[model samples]
Target chain A: GAGVSQSPSNKVTEKGKDVELRCDPISGHTALYWYRQRLGQGLEFLIYFQGNSAPDKSGLPSDRFSAERTGESVSTLTIQRTQQEDSAVYLCASSPGQGAIEQFFGPGTRLTVL
Target chain B: DQQVKQNSPSLSVQEGRISILNCDYTNSMFDYFLWYKKYPAEGPTFLISISSIKDKNEDGRFTVFLNKSAKHLSLHIVPSQPGDSAVYFCAASSGTSGTYKYIFGTGTRLKVLA
Candidate 1:
C-alpha cells in the first residue's frame, strides 16, 4: 500500500471481551509504532517495532496489552479482557528505520468497549 | 505527571488570524519535537518537526518555536482557516535511548470560525 493501513475502522466490544486490531505498515518502512488516543486526551505511545522485532514494548500499560509484527509488515495489537477504559482510538504509524522524526500514520481503529 | 503537557484543551480563533498552541516538557533528554494534526475519526498526520540543535522551524503556514531553557514549544498557524480546525498534538522523542517511545501531550483543539 502507498500508506499505512489498519483494519476494522471501528470495533464495539463488550467489557471483558478480547479484541484484536491489525495494522499493515507502508511497504519498505522498517519502523512501526502503535498509540492510543482517548477522547480529548493526547496520544499515548503503546509499542514500537523495528523490522520484525519490537525493541520497545515498555509503553504497554499492563499485561493485557500485547503486540506482534511479522516480517516487518503486518502488526496486530491484542487486548485481552477489555475494560471500558480501553476504549480509544488506536493508531499505527510507520517510518524509515533510521529516521526518528518522520512518520506516516494510518486511519486508526476506534475501539469502543462498552 | 505528564512530561509533555498541553495545558489548554481548546482554543477559538478567527479566520485569517494566527492560532498559537503551546506545549511543555519536563524531560531534558528529549532532543526532537514534532507536531501532528488530527481530525475527528482520523489518525494524526505529521505536520512539522524540529531538532534540538535548532530553535525554530517553519513550513508554509505552520511554524514551530522551541525554547529549550523553558522546556516549552509552540506551534503557530498563520491565516488560520476553517480547514485548519483540528486537534494538534505535540510530541517529543528522547535522545535515542528511551525505547523509541515518543511522548505526546494531551492535545489542543483549535476551532477556526470563519
Candidate 2:
C-alpha cells in the first residue's frame, strides 16, 4: 500500500468479546502510534511505538487495552472484553523516527462494541 | 484535564471566505505544534506545523499563528473552499516523557458551504 493500511476497516463485536485491530504503517518508517476517537469527541492517544519499544503506555484507558508493535512494521491493538464505551475508530500513524516529522495516517479500523 | 483543547466543536464558512480554527494548550514545555484534517471514514492527514521559535507560519492559503505567552494557536484558511470541509485537529508535543510523543486536541468540525 502506498499509505498506512489497517485491517477489518469495520468490526462489530459483542460486549464481552475480545477484538484485535491491526495496523500496517508505511514502509521504512520507524515510529508508529495508535489513537482512538469516539463520536463527538477528539482523538485520544492510545500507545506509541518507536522501533519495537513502547516506553510510554500511560494513554491506555485500562489494563484491558494492550498494543504491540514489531519495529516500524505491523502493530496490533487488542481489547480484552469489549464494553460499550470501547466503541471508536482506531487510528494508526507512522513517521520517520519520531520528533518533528509529519505523520502519515492509515484509513483506520472502526470498532463498534454492541 | 486536557493538555490540548479546541474550544469550538464546529464552525461554518461560505466558500471563498476565511475559516479560522483555534486551539489552546496549558503546557509551556511544548516545542512543536501541528494541525491535521480528517474526513469521515478516513484518518487525519498532516496539514501544517510550526516550531516554538516562530509565531507565524504559512503555506499557500493556510496560515498558522502561535502565541507563546497566551498558550494559543490558530489556523486560518483564506478563501475557504467546499473541499476544505472536514474536522481539524490541533496537536502539541514537548517530546514524549522519554520517547517524545504528541498530544492531540479534540478537533473542530468545519462545514464549508458552496
Clashes of 2: 3
Q: Could you report the DockQ of all the candidates, in the order they appear?
A: 0.65, 0.65
Alpha-carbon deviation at A10 in model 1, angstroms: 0.8
DockQ, model 2, C-alpha based? 0.65
Residue range B1-114, candidate 2, lDDT tens digits: 899999999999999999999999999999889999999888899999998999999999999999999999999999899999999999998864544477889999999999
Give candidate 1 misplaced runs (Cα > 4 Å).
Answer: B98-100
Top-DockQ structure, candidate number:
1
lDDT (0-100) at residue A40 of candidate 2? Answer: 77
Displacement of residue B31 (Cα, Å) in model 2 is 1.1
Give fnat (model 2).
Answer: 0.68
Tell me how candidate 1 scores on lDDT. Answer: 0.90
lDDT (tens digit, per residue) of candidate 2 on A13-59: 99999999999988998888888888877778888888756446888
Model 1: C-alpha RMSD to truth? 1.5
Q: Show the colliding residue pairs in model 1.
A: none
TM-score of each: 0.95, 0.95
The recovered share of true contacts, given per candidate in order, is 0.74, 0.68
Q: Give the alpha-carbon lDDT of every model.
A: 0.90, 0.90
Which lDDT value does model 2 have at B81? 99
